[model samples]
Target: MHAKLTTGAMLLAMSTLLLPAAAAPDWQMVAKTFGKSGTETPDGVYRIGLPRTDLKVSLDGVALKPGFALGGWIAFEPMGNQAMVMGDIVLTQDEVNPVMKKLEESGIEITALHNHLLRAEPMTLYMHVFGQGDPVTLATALHAGLALSKTPMENAAKPQASAQQIELDTAAVDQAIGHKGKANGGVYQFSIPRAETITDSGMQVPASMGSAIAINFQRTGAGKAAITGDFVLIASEVNPDEQPRLFFMHFWANDDAVKLGRGLKAALDKMDLKNS
Candidate 1:
């Protein structure tokens, strides 16, 4: 009976040891290191939005709002004892190289650097950064890189008082889109996940990594608004004709998914003929 009791206690201790460790993200340290507050998603990702309010951008003679073009963001997701960070930083032509150098020096990888818009008054570029390490260290590196640019560290810019009210029926828009949205700096923003799962490098990609379809609306007038943002789609879902052309499709002044789907299909068909 003593041997049996010893065996049972040993089994219980082993089972406890084999159990999964609790996920604990040091959010306070992350915020302190980044010098900005962040919002935690339901899935436990802490996301910080750093909009370039100092930039006054114009496209085709229309003044572009920060929500429309100058939004930079970083997200941290807990990965076991460490954390994984992914971010897109907006920079001017001159600021790009300096910021890139800072991030590289800090051991962050530059995944992609490209233009999000075709032609604007002052050209803008986006740098995509990825890093995995101690969460506070990652945030510190990110903060240092951002300091190289004119990007605001915190709520440095005062909110503009608008005489015009928001014209779009936001509640209806949310219902139609199947997701709730938040208003930020005069833009109604929605971050919606794909119905299907998304994976990268054989691992599941979370919505916090800018993998969700981001839609933004800036009110122009009564019942009128300018819409802009991108839709995240995988290769198979984006193009059925040509060799899987996976990319985010950015749209301006349009929010119809069916029309965009048709446009993508047509473009793919044309590419297929060219390849053939």
Candidate 2:
């Protein structure tokens, strides 16, 4: 009986030794590979934003700021020993094919390629990409894809100073929104992630992966600015109607705080009704 017990104990020890050890993801390498800094969300996802500051886009004679309409972002989440990545890249008409080719050649899947707006000048397109592999490898692939376009790489050009002085109460706006925002190329931008989990393709998709509500305010004049951006949502959260709508809105303000509040509340009401 003693001999049998010894053999069983030895077998158990060997099995434990044979089991694969869990490895923590190297987030620094991912950021370095992408040529940008990143942050880890509350849901334990690492994300980086890449705004298209190179493009000068417009809609209906109004110039569209980068934060307003030309932002791209990538998110990384640990999955077992590897990592999963998802991103949406904004591309101009001429840069689409080249960037798509790069992404495809690097083993990244193009999940979607579509327009986010109509009647926009210089036509813009959004390309959604996905990959599952080493986080650093995925970032490298994304960098290569972005390089094919005019998308600025690290230190390509310093952000130009705004010619028009900002007159809006930015601090008040941030406090009212309940989140701090950053000023990028004259646009005050906020990225607020949902407090719930989002999933796609049987995998948990983090809020940083195009699942957050993006808000941008561009200073247009004294005590005035133009607000625009989109609320990212999954298919199930979208309204199933004849037009298949996703929540989106825009506002042009000129020193009218009450009017702005009312407009935003009305837009939210409409969105809630559609989703309901």
Best by TM-score: 1
- The sequence of per-residue lDDT tens digits that candidate 2 reaches over residues 142-179 is 98998888776554355556633345798999888899
Worst 10 residues of 1 by lDDT: 156-165
List RMSD in Å for every model shown: 10.0, 12.5
- Quantify all predictions' global Cα lDDT against the true fold: 0.82, 0.80
In model 2, the worst 10-residue window by lDDT is: 156-165
RMSD of 2: 12.5
Off by over 4 Å in 1: 1-23, 156-165, 171-180, 201-203, 240-276
Q: In each prediction, how many residue pairs overlap at the backbone (N, C-alpha, C within less than 3 A)?
A: 0, 0
The alpha-carbon deviation from the true structure for residue 160 of candidate 2, after best TM-score superposition, in angstroms, is 12
- Clashing residue pairs in candidate 1 are none
